[model samples]
Target: GGLPYVLTAHEGSAAFAADVMGRLTGAPGLCIATLGPGATNLTTGVGNAYLDRSPLLALTCNLPTAQLGRRIQMAIDHHALFRPLTKATLALREGAVASVLAEALQVALSEPLGPVHLDLPEDVALAPATEAVPAPPSGRRLAAAPEPARRRAAELLGAARRPVAVLGSSAMRLRNPGLLQAVIERHRLPFATTTMAKGMISEEHPLSLGCIERARRQVQRELLGGADLVVGLGYDVVEVEYEAWLGKVPLLSIDVDPVDADASVTIAHEVVGDLDASLGWLAQLPPARPEWGADLAARHRERFQRALRPPRAGFVPHHAIDVVRAALPRDGILAFDVGAHTHQIASQWTAHAPRTFLITNGWSSMGFGLPAAIAAKLACPERPVVAIVGDGCFQMTVGEVAVARRLGLSLPIVVLDDGWLSLIQVKQVRRRFGLYGTDLGEQALVDPPAHYFGVPAIGAGSAAELARALTDALVADHPTVIEARVDPGHYLDTVYD
Candidate 1:
C-alpha cells in the first residue's frame, strides 16, 4: 500500500501514464486526483484512453453525498459521460469501497478493456468498512467457451492454404508472443500487427510480417487481400483503415470480449476465451503446410525490402527517422503522436518488440507522443524512450519537457519543426477546406527554444547536426531536446492530401 507517489505537473500526463502502464503490463493502469477541478482536467486523458480501448483506472474525489447535485459545477454526470467510452463507471456509495474496488478491477481487466472511472467522495474514502474487501478471482482466468466455437476456429486455421494472422493491442497485452510465434512457426504463417501492436513479436523473426499501418500500399493490395483466410486475433478493425476491404477476406475472429465483435462482422467463426489457451489448442492440430508458409514469408520480406528506400540524402523525413533509428538501440522504444510526420515515421521506423511503439491510433490525438514517452519511461525505467513529436504538437505539451527533466528521466525528444501544421497545411492545399487555419508564423515557433527545461537544447539544420544531438543525448546523464528543423516540402508525400 505504501507505493511512492509522483506529483505530475498536469492531470493529462498522469492519465497518459496510467494508460501506458496499463497497456504495457497487461494490468489495469491507475490515476488518482483530488476533487472538483482535478476531475474535470483529467477527463480529456480519460476520454482518450477510453476511445483507444486502453485498460485504465481513473480515481477522483468528490464532495460529500450531502452536496450531491447542488449548484456544483464539478458535479457533472461522471457515470453518464463515461458510459460511451467505458465498460463500467461507478460512484462509490457508503461502505462500498472494498466490493466496488473488486468489481471495478474485474471490469477493468476484462476483455475489450477500457478506461474505468471511480468517483470516491472524501468522506467515503476515509470511512473504513468493517468487513474485509473480498478478493477478486484471478483476472487472467478464462471463462469456459462452447466446444462448437473452438472446433470451428480450429477447422478454419487448419484447412486454409494461404492464411495469415493479424495481432492487435489486446494480443500484445496477453503477452503470448511465444505462443503466437509457436503457432506461426508450426503453421508457417506470416504475422502482421496493427499500429498499436508493434513489437508483440521480435521484428528480427523471419516470419514477422511487420505493422499493417506501415506496410506498403502494394503489400496491402497484394498480400493482405490476397490471403484465402485471415485470423484477426484480438484485432479491432475499428482502429485500422481498410476495414471494408478486410470484409472481403474470410475472417476468423478471436476476441475474449463480446464488445469486440463488430455489427458488420465478416467473421466466419468466432472464438473467445483466454487467447493463449485457445491458440495453444489450435496449434496442436495438424501443422499448416510449410510450402504455404514459405510463399507468404518470401512475399512479405520482398515487399518490406521494396517499401524501404535508403532514407533519401540530406534533410528528408526518412532521413530523420533513419537518424533516430540509427542512434537508438535495436530494441529501444519509440512513441509517435498523430501528425503528418507519423505516416512517414510509422512506415520507416522499425519496431522490434511489443509495447516498443506507442501511439493513439483510434483517437489520433495530437500532443500525445511526449506524454506517451514520459509514461513509457516511468513504466520501464531501464529502456531508452524516444518521442518523435511535430512542431505544432511540441508547442502543446512542451511544458512536459520540464516535467521530464524534473522527474530526472533522461528522455530524448526529437521535434520535427516545419513552420506550418503540415498535415492540415496539406489538407488546405488539397482544397478540402476553403479556409486554412493551419498557417502559423514565427510567433508559433517557441522563440529562443534553444534552452529547453534549462538544459541546452540543440537545433539541427542538417543530418550532421541531427547526428550530434542524438549522440549527446545517448551519452548524457541528463535529458536532452534535439530540435531538428525540417523543410515542410520534405514531407510532401504525407503533407499532400
Candidate 2:
C-alpha cells in the first residue's frame, strides 16, 4: 500500500516503463492494468520484456468470479492471452493470493529473467485474506563453474594468441562488473558489446573496441577475423545472431544458460554458471598475452573517432548525438528508438556506465525511447534523462508527452524529423524497390505557437540550433520536444552500404 505508482498515457506502452526499471534496478518491475482491452494493450510491453529478458510483474484486474465463465463484457481469458508472453500466468485465488504473488515474483526474477502475469479477479481481490503473506524468497544463488568446464575454458583461452570478449545483455546482470573487468584487463583482451549491452562496460575504457551495431560491423568483422578465439561472456543469441559468429575461430561461452547450439556457432568450450564466478575463475588463471589486440583496438578507435566527427553541413544525426553527449552529464541516461539514427547513436555514443544508454535492441521496438526515458527518469530522478527518437517513432508514442508533462518531469524528447520512415526507405531503395510507404509528406508542427499536446515544441535545423534547443529543454521545468530537421541521406552510406 505504501508503494508508489506512475500513470502513463497508454496502458500498452507502460511496459516500456517496466522494461527500463527492471533493467536499471535488476528487480521485478510492476505494471498494473484492468482486464480485457487494458490487458491486451499491455501485451506489447509484456512481450518486449519477455524477449528482452527484463524481469516484470504484470498485474491485471479481472472481472468478478461470477462473470468469468460467461460471455459477458470485458471477460476475456487473461491467462490464455498472457501465457505466450510471460514466464508463468496465474489467476489469483481467494486464499492463496500472497503465495501466488510470491511464486510469480520468483519466476520473474529467476535466471534469464522475464515477465510474469497474474490476473487478480475483482472478487478475489476484494475477499479477505486469512493466510499470512510469505516472506520473500532468498536471493538467487549463482552456481559455481564446473571444474572440468573451467579447465577446458582456461586451456582454450591460454592457447589462443588473439582472444576477444563479446559482452551481451546478460552481462548487465552481473553482481560485480569489476570481477568481469578484471578478467578483461588482466588478460588485455579487446572487448566489444552487443547493441543491447552497449553500456555493460564503460566504452571509454582502453580495452573497449566498441558496440557491435550495424554501423561498426566493418571494424568488428576485421577484429573477429584476426581473433583466434571468441570468448562470449553472458552472450545472448537474441542480440546478435549466432550466424554472425560462425567462422574458423571457435567460441568459449560463459553464461547462466547453455549456448544456442542451433545457431551453427562453434563452442569449443563453455562454463555455465554465474558470470561473475566464471570470470573470477578465469581471472585467477595466468594472464594471457598483454598485446593481443592492442593495435587492432587502436585502429578501431581511430575509425570510430572519425565516424563520430561527421560533416556539420546540416543537422547530421551523428553530430547531433555528439552534441547531446557533450551537453548531458557523463552519467545522464539516454534512450534511443529503432531507426537509422539508432545505428549511429548505438555505435558512437560512449556510455560511461551501465544503464546509461538504453535501447530495445533485442526487440528493436519503435516508440520505446520516450516511455523508457520517462521510466529511467523515475528510477534515477537525480540523473537527467533524454530520448532520441525518429519522426516515425515519435508519432507512434507522441501522446506519452502528456504523461511526462503531467508528472512534471524535465525530460527532453529529441525527434530526428526526417519526414519519413528512413530506415525502411533505405532498405527499399537498396533492394531496388521504389519508395512506396516510407514517405511522410511535409506537415509543419513546429511553426510559431506550436505545442505538442501542451508540451513546448521547438525546431532545430542545424547542429548549433539543436544544441541550443537541447540546452533550453534540459533546463526547463517541464518536458519539451525538440524536432530537429535531419537528412536521412547518410543512411545510404553508413547503414545500407
Candidate 3:
C-alpha cells in the first residue's frame, strides 16, 4: 500500500487520523499502539469510527503468550477494552498473523464499515518465518435493491404530492455517487442533506434545500413534514434518526444497510442493497409532479442563509467561520472539532464534494479537527486543507500542531478563542446557573502566543486580519496557527436553546 505512516502527538490523535484515512480512502485504516494506556486512549476515536461507520484496523501489543493473562506490568486486556468499541476484536497468534490480519481487514471493510482490533503478543511481533501479507481486497459490486422493493418505492414516489430525497454520508461511499443527483433531478424532486452529506451534490445546485440538523432547523423540519414521501439516499439513522424528522410520513429508504425494523417511523417501502445500483432502478420511476417545488426550496435556502449569519456580532465565532469559508475554495477540505462552533459550521460551510467537509457527528468528540485535517493533508497533499477548532477543543490536541510542523505541511489551524466552554456555558445560562468553571481564564483578554511549539502562530482580532491571515497561511510552506479572538455569545441565541 502507498499509505503514509504519520506519527501523531497522541494515540487518540492517531486514532482520529486513522478514521479520517478510512473515510477518505474507503479502505481499512491502520493504527498501532502500545499496551494499556495507549490502547485506552485510542478508544474514543475508535468508538467514533464504530458509530460513524468508518473502516479502521486498530492494532495493540500485549504480553507474551507465556505470561498472557498474568498480572503483568503495563498490560491490560486489549480485547476486552476494544470489544465494545470495535466491530470485532482478535488476538494474532504466532503463525496465523497473515491470516488473522486478512480477516481483520475484511471485517473492518464490510458494509457499514467499522473499526476492528487485533492484538499481537510480544513474542509474535519478534517471530520469523512469517509470510508476507497479500494484496488488499478490491471493490465488489454490492447487490442492488430487489425488483419488487425498488418498484414499490418508485410507486410511492410517483403517487406522493410531496417527496424529498435526503442524502446522507453513506451515499458518498457508494460507487458513482453522481447517480444520487441523477435520480433526484430526474424527478425534479427537492432535496435536503444531512450534515455529513452536504456536498455530495453541489449545495449551489438549484434543487438544494441546504442542510438539516443545524441552523434554522425548524424550516428544514417543516419542509420535511410537508413531504408525503421521504426517500433516504444512502442515509444512516446514526447521523439523525428517522423519528426525529420523518414523523409518521411514509419512508422509502434505499441504502447499503437495511432500515432498522424496530424504528418507530413508518416504512412505505424499505429497499436495501447497492445504493448506486438502486439509484439506477429509481431512474425508471414514473416522475411525480411535486407540489412542493423550487419556490419552497428557494425560500428555505434563503432562510437558512439568513439564520446562518452570525447575529449581533462584534467578532463572534460565526463571523470567523464566515471569513474562513469565504477565503477557502469551494473544493477545499475543512475538518472541525466539536463545540459550539460546530453548530454554525455544519450548515454555514459550503461543501462542494463528499469528504471535503469532515466533522465527527455521530461520536462527536473534541480534539478530532486537527488530527483529521492532518490526515486529509497527508491523503491529498495537493489540496488546501484547514482545521477550525474552538479554544477549549484545540487545547485537547495542541501538541498535534507540532506533528504538522514536523511534516512541514502547509496547513492552517484556525483557533477561535472564546474563553469559555461556550456551548456548555450557554446551557447553564438558560437555567440561570453561575458560569463558574466554564471560563478558560479569560482567553480572549490574554495575549496570543507567536507560535505553538515550532509552528508559526498569528493573531486575528478582526475580520480583515483573519482573512489576511488565512490568505497567508493557506500558501505558507509550513503549518500555521491563526488564533482569532471572538465572543461565542451569539451561540447563546442560536443553537443554545
Writing each residue's lDDT as its tens digit, candidate 1 over 1-497 gives: 86557667678777877788888776777888776778767776777788677788888888787886677866766666667766788888886777888888888776666788898876887786776858653454576457788888777777787788887766765646677677777777787777777677776677767666542434554677778888877676566744544657778877665434345646677787777777777668788653454556657766665565434455766667789988888678897778878766665567876678888777777878888888888888888888889878888888888888888887788988777787777666677566467765643454345687676687887878888888878666667888887766645443321
| Model 3, span 1-497: residue lDDT tens | 66567788899999999999998888877888999898898888899899888999999988889988888788888888999899899989988988888888888877768899999888999889568877776444567777888777877888888888898878867768788888878898888889888789988888888888775567678778888888888888788788876788788888888787456788888888977788887776667778875577777888877876745757877789889989888889999999888877887777788779998878888989999999999888999999999989898999999999999999999999988888788778988998877889865365577788989889888899999999999999999999899877778666743
Model 2, 328: alpha-carbon shift in Å?
A: 1.1
Can you write out model 2's per-residue Cα lDDT over 1-497, one digit (the tens) per residue?
76688888888678888988999897888999998899999998898899899999999998888788778888789989999989999888898888988898888888778999998989998888789979876336668888999998888888888888988888877778777688888888899888888777788788888877567467667777788888988888888776665466788998888888664666788789877788888889998874464576777877976764555566677777877898899899998899888887877788988778888877788888999999999899988988899989988998999999989999988888888898888889889999998888854544423788899998887889889998988988999998888777777767734
Residue 266's lDDT within candidate 2 is 69
Stretches of candidate 3 off by over 4 Å are: 1-3, 139-142, 261-264, 431-436
For residue 224, what is the lDDT in candidate 3? 86
After superposition, candidate 2 runs with Cα above 4 Å error: 261-263, 290-293, 308-312, 443-449
Estimate the TM-score for candidate 1: 0.89
- Pairwise lDDT winner, candidates 2 and 3: 3
How many clashes (backbone atoms < 3 Å, residues ≥3 apart in a chain or on different chains) does model 2 have?
1
